[model samples]
Target: MYLQHFALTQLPFSLTPNTAFYVGLAPHQQAFEVLQTALAAGEGFIKISGEVGTGKTLLCRKLLHTAPAHWRLAYLPDPALSPMELRWALAAELGLQYSGNIDQQQLHQLLQRHLLLLAARELQVILVIDEAQALPDETLEALRLLTNLETEQRKLLQVVLFAQPELDLRLAKHQFRQLRQRISFSYRLRPMTVAEVAAYVQTRLSIAGNPQLRFSPFALNRLASGSRGIPRLVNVLAHKAMMLAYGRGQQQISWWHVRAAAKDTEDVQAEPAFIWLSAALMVVVIFGMLFWQWGPL
Candidate 1:
């Protein structure tokens, strides 16, 4: 809706984990580097945890895109499946054909044979699981057993988990110790800093075909504050603010629009005093313009 008003070619703040909007800020870049290094070194298990809306899925997609050609990737976006279902899913990803009557032992043997075949071709198998915190204990234990498929010289399969902070708490349980211990490399994704948020907004706007147009400095500050430096929240507020500005036929988003959008957002609330200040500032600007146009000579 705001695209036509702002001269933007596309919606810049979509919540989809689009790699095109990826900002490569410090934390995300560091996590990418760690993932690349661990995967290259053939680490059996690697964990990356972050708060909700901290770009875990984006990073997961990025890893899929950037992984080396020698690596075969199996992505498990839903971990709600039972242990047997998990095996079937993995087998399917590896292109293993199976009959519905196949038992658990038969499935395991099929997966093992497929993995060995891939290994013989000098291909490394990598399993990536998202929302790993929801994985049932039995499923997690089953994953641990899968990781056990390896040669005497090295592991045949590497597993990478992307999850929210709750995964850490889950892993702290004694039952998960074995899985935790196998994680040779791990990274925690953090939210953007205020400065990073500003840059992130500008970068997205520029990518959307608006290099000169921008949120005013005050508006940017308010957005960063209200979003708590979270990139997803920043995107939401900024997108809403742009829509508000478009509704009023404005090119630059002012602090007033940002404050209003923040109030409208369920997760964000601006101080009443600040809202009054924004209104006062708008009045002053309007008065200043009128005085310059028609004041006493």
Candidate 2:
């Protein structure tokens, strides 16, 4: 509804993990580089871990989108499969045709033969699993066994796991030692910084065709602080702030709009009773800083 008011052609802050709106912030960029390098080096297993809403899914999609031509990618967005189901899913992703009543051993043979065929054709097969933290223990072990399907030169299937931080805790157990050992490279995504959050908002706005629609310094600072520099929270606050501005028929987002948005959002970590008073004080402080930074904004 606010798209026309904000001169935006698309929703800039939608929660979906769309690669077109991906921001190459420091953490995401470094993680991408690490994944590319590790995959290029023919590592059998790699992992990218982040807190929820830290863009792991977005980065995973970006990696899949830019994967090398020699690599065939199989994506598993849900990891709640049993060992047998996991095998079937992998077989399906690899386009292996098999009977519905196929036994586990038969399914495994079919998958291994398909992988061998791909390897013979000089193509590397990659399985990228998202939400890997939810994978059952036996399923994870099955994945490790998949990596063991290698020739003398290179692995038949490389796996890149994109999961939340809980995946690391799961891997710390003695039961997962073999799977953990196979992870040749790993990257942890960090939350964005305050400045990075500001730039992120601007970048998305530019992508949505409205670079001129600006968030005031005070509002942006409140957004950055309340969101704790997390991209998803920032998006939520920004979208709500813009809606407030649209309601008031205002062109630029202000501190009051951000304060109201933060007060309404459960993720903003604001004390319910102190929102208005804190906003008043923060406005004074923010204006003072703004004046000092820009010589009377």
Candidate 3:
């Protein structure tokens, strides 16, 4: 609704993880480098863990797009499958079609054959699993076994797990010792800093074809504090603040817009100290304007 008012071609703060709007924040960039280096080394298991809204999916998409030509990527966005289901999913990714009446043993044989064929062709098959915390214990073991199809040089199937921190806790258990031992590279994603948050907002706006609309320093501070530098919350608050500014016919976003936005967002925590200080400053400004105009208390 504010596209024309703000001179933007697209909405900048959408929650969907779009690579076009990606800003290589320090943590994401570091994670990207680690993934690339690990994959190049033919690591059997690699893990990337972060909190809920720290841009894991975006980084996954970035890796997919930038992977080398010889790389074959199979992405599993949902991981709540049983062991048999996991095999079937991997088989489908490998383009191995069979009758529904085939038994689990037969399916596994076919899948292994296909992976061997791909390895012969010099194709590096990478299975990237998002939301990996939901993977069951049996399914995790099945995935590990698939990586056991290696020749003397490198693994036939490599796995990159993009998950929340809960996945780390799961892997720390005794049942997951094998999978943990196979992990050659792991990274923990960090939240953005205040400066990174500001840069993130501007980057999105610029991608959406920003012309003149801008956020005030007060608004940026409130957003960074309220969102705690989380990218998803920053996007939610920023979108709401832009809507408020447009509704008020204002050219710039101020602390009032951000304050109202934070109150509306469920996950955002209000920062009361700065809120009271801003209120006091507003009152002093109002009093000064009144005294200059009509003289008096």
> Pick by TM-score: which candidate is best?
3
TM-score of 1: 0.90
Per-candidate TM equals 0.90, 0.91, 0.92
lDDT of each model, Cα atoms only? 0.89, 0.91, 0.91
Query: Lowest-scoring 10 consecutive residues by lDDT in candidate 2?
Result: 267-276
Off by over 4 Å in 1: 269-297
Q: Pull out the clashing pairs in model 2.
A: none
Cα lDDT tens digits for candidate 3, 1-297 = 999999899999999999999998899999999999999999999999999999999999999888888998888999999999998888888787788899989988888788889889999999999999999989999999888988899898999999999999999999999889999999999888889988888889999998456788879988999998899999999999999999999879898999999998898876868668998999999999999999997
Q: State the lDDT of candidate 2 residue by residue for 97-186, as single tens digits.
A: 899998999888889899999999999899999999999988899889988999999999999999999999999999999888999999
Cα-based lDDT at residue 251, candidate 2: 94
lDDT (C-alpha) at residue 124 in model 3: 98
lDDT of 1 by residue, 1-297 (tens): 978778889888998988888888899999999999998888899999998888899999998887778989999999988999999999888888889998999998889989999999999999999999989999999999999999987798999999999989989999899998999999999878878888889998888888888889989889888887777888788888888898899999998898888988877645558767998999999999989999954
- What would the C-alpha RMSD of candidate 2 be, to one decimal place? 5.3
Clashes of 1: 0
Please list the residue runs of candidate 3 whose C-alpha ends up more than 4 Å from where it truly belongs after superposition: 274-297
